[model samples]
Target: MTILLSQEIDRTSYEPAYAQLVNILQASMATGVFKPGAQLPSEAQLCEHYKVSPMTVRRVINILLDRGLVTTAQGRGTFVKGVDIGEAVFHLSGLKEQIESTDRAQVQLLEARIVEAPERVARKLELSPVDWTIFVRRLLLQDGTPVSYHRAYLIYDPRRPIVEGELEVTSLEGLIHGNGQTDLQSGCLSIEAVTLKEEEAAILSMGQGDPAFLIDHTFYDFQDRPVSWGWFIWRADRLKLSATIGNRPPQDQQSAMKDSRRWTGEDHE
Candidate 1:
């Protein structure tokens, strides 16, 4: 299939052609320009379009394969991998708590203050543009190494001791549900891939423009009103997320498997 690339590698840049191509293809995949199971352009086509050597294209493809983003079939070419959203369900949890189980982890509260809400944060937290919110910044360290950073904005309530509550695990209750709090009621989470900026990289002890995972979460009350919004920036090398797809008893699981086989005609033999 013929593919039209919207961007090309800058040969004059210090970065290699392979790396640039990899990022381009990754962006294409992220934007759904190249849908799942769609065949990537042939090696010859990419080589001609991007003016890169076959080795460069091969290296980029290999990198994609390592990331589990694409697969190459012998003689058939490469195709994007289809993702099943139902297969992975990440729970709402703190980055510090998530890494503390297996590693010696610590969280440092860098800053906590009431600040004018950014337009994006105001929109997310469902607050007016003129409203002020509590901004909290934290750094998570695993085994004494910085691994993740967090930035949160909470709805300001004068009755709630937000700064102190923001420091403790149970404090999320106060921030989310307002003054008298017990536990988390409900929330939402989103994950995306991002590159570190100068400030973020410096804080995380990573190189500027390095890849990382951005986790955005919003907490809501029983009334379904948005209470808080925040995001965590985690080093890509330090985190891995997985989930079990289904919950079934042993007998039920076996029966389901057999039914699937019967439907697929595998039970005929």
Candidate 2:
């Protein structure tokens, strides 16, 4: 099939041709320019259109394969994956918790193993730069449509075999809590706006540079030690987010005022 590419890779920049091509293709797929089951342009066509080598095209194709964006058949060319949606998901709990509560949500584990985390993630999980961490990657789907991508990092317990003990653990927090080592009691989570990268765009079937939510969450054990640090990226249009805050009791408010007055050296009597 003859596919039209809207953007060209800047060869002068340090970014490689394949990476740029991946980004371009991801944007097109996310925007529904190419629907699922639609055949991607042949390698030779991509090479000609992008003015890059066939090897570059293949490399980019491999990335899309790894990301579960497109599948290649033995005799046929690669085609986009299907993304079907139903009623959108709303949020009151964490992603895993939300998935657990929802009846129709299904989890597809992409990768799960022990791996070394990056600098910021390492710091967040209170692990040394070189320490190995348990990494869990999965996709949450609702009605056969991928809704979010979740990556969680946990401090690997050496004595306990986490994989064996928590083989059926559904949630990241549950994975830690069920280990019989420490209970994850609470989480501190912050949500911010983020632009979907090429890889994320491909995984979630959204356009590249699309608006999404970057949820950074840290789970704390009963002792208040950070047990895990997780990141979740949800497609902007795939979910609606809401929160509920209750009013503080009058006694709690009075106590807060008294504490403030005591700190400020005001008359407490």
Candidate 3:
């Protein structure tokens, strides 16, 4: 508790007492004064040391809980939470941008041709099985090591520029953000753990039946119509998703909402 007492709540500042206390505790944690899993001072101790009421200390604890900075047990006191890397947010653009940001990243076009829409893909894209669709496959690599295999089925539209640029990795951004053909209104993504099949294994240069991640994506137009559908198979060790949590300004909240809408296809009027 000596470390916690080194920083006192500012009494004269315009900031609320609770806010100042929170900053003190947060700063202590940042400096490793309060290591992960360390128990915080008891409510009585905090109240006595800070000269604050029990309600204020409780409120501070609640705020810490909301920020995911601490956890509480029924019988035990609050403790600092250990950072868990697996607790991360998944974002489509984030993943794409991360791969491209790598200096040695490369994208190789494997196949691009018209093919009859598969029943599942047709249903997902709201197309008939008899309709023709553009089938595109690409391999993503980093430093010459295969990382992901991309397979997509797009609605056949010769007039759209997306079809022409679909063969290039740069155009993948157009597919997500939209090309002149149709602006991307929204989209949804699903990911699951899967074992690599023979073909998938060969493409990723991994052993057959190796663990991998399968991400399915579906994009829609402003009309709420499905425009494109595809999946990306990634090596298990190649990707890790992360996101910011806790308080944000109104503008930042709005921006996060827009990103959510783009990825989840949630229509917000």
Candidate 4:
């Protein structure tokens, strides 16, 4: 879209010219006229386009740079960096525990019940149609602010009665370990950005078009048998994710510490 920068700037207004310029550019960005990594016009081009002085344009660009909305190269000119919400860190834990760690949120257990596994779930858990599972639904809050809705399912074994009760006190992984199931090992997770559906938005206390992070996690035992599966839908505005990718855990363990420190700095920054 061709934004008429000059027309959008109100000359009679009390706002500074640079501030007005920033506002114009921000509006253009919000409307999708400018995109991430898209090159912005040079200072001279902006000066000419807006009918403003070169210094005024530079000042506006500087503001955007500080906000991490754009980055400038020595010779290539300015480019949009998009809005960096900063680093997001996520931990695997029960809904209540995770929210409590933030100290800014609360959690409400919306529903907790045991039910027969659906066909898909039964297949994933490698269970018969008669097998049952515990379904727990919860809402997460931040500083008393509602943020996300989550649902988790664990295959129920009659032999593991302790596992059922521990769900209320510990994370799935923790409960598994407490049950003397230390043989449990790692599994894969998939994450994606999505827009909330109408029903999801109502339960999450968000608008229908609001952004969300959908995470699908599957857990397995040392024998590589799927043990549990969980689905979480988190508000994009409230949560952040952090992950570490590397070679398998080191054998020396000492080297792992050094590697962890290095990656932590890079990831957090």
Question: Which candidate has the highest lDDT of all?
Answer: 3
lDDT of 3 by residue, 1-269 (tens): 54346768788989999998888777667667778889988888999899999999999999888778889997788898877655545455446664645477777889888999999988988888998788889898888999889988888766555544433422454544344454566778899999999999998999999988999988766677776789999987776554654322224533544433224555574
Relative to the true structure, candidate 1 reaches a TM of 0.51
TM-score of 3: 0.56
Candidates' C-alpha lDDT:
0.75, 0.72, 0.75, 0.69
Ten contiguous residues with the weakest lDDT in model 4: 241-250
Q: What are the per-residue Cα lDDT tens digits for candidate 4 across 205-234?
A: 889988888978777766677777777788
* Model 2, TM vs. native: 0.48
lDDT of 4 at 215: 78
Ranking by TM-score: 3, 1, 2, 4
Instruction: Check candidate 4 and list the clashing pairs.
Output: 104-142, 104-143, 105-141, 105-142, 105-143
Candidate 2 regions with alpha-carbon error over 4 angstroms:
1-103, 159-182, 243-269
Give the winner by TM-score. 3
What candidate 1 gets wrong by more than 4 Å, as runs, is 1-103, 159-183, 243-269
Model 2 — which ten-residue stretch has the worst lDDT? 242-251
TM per candidate: 0.51, 0.48, 0.56, 0.47
In model 2, what is the error at residue 110, expressed in angstroms?
0.3
Residue 112 Cα positional deviation in candidate 4, in Å, after optimal superposition: 0.9
User: Poorest 10 consecutive residues of model 3 by lDDT?
Assistant: 245-254
lDDT of 1: 0.75
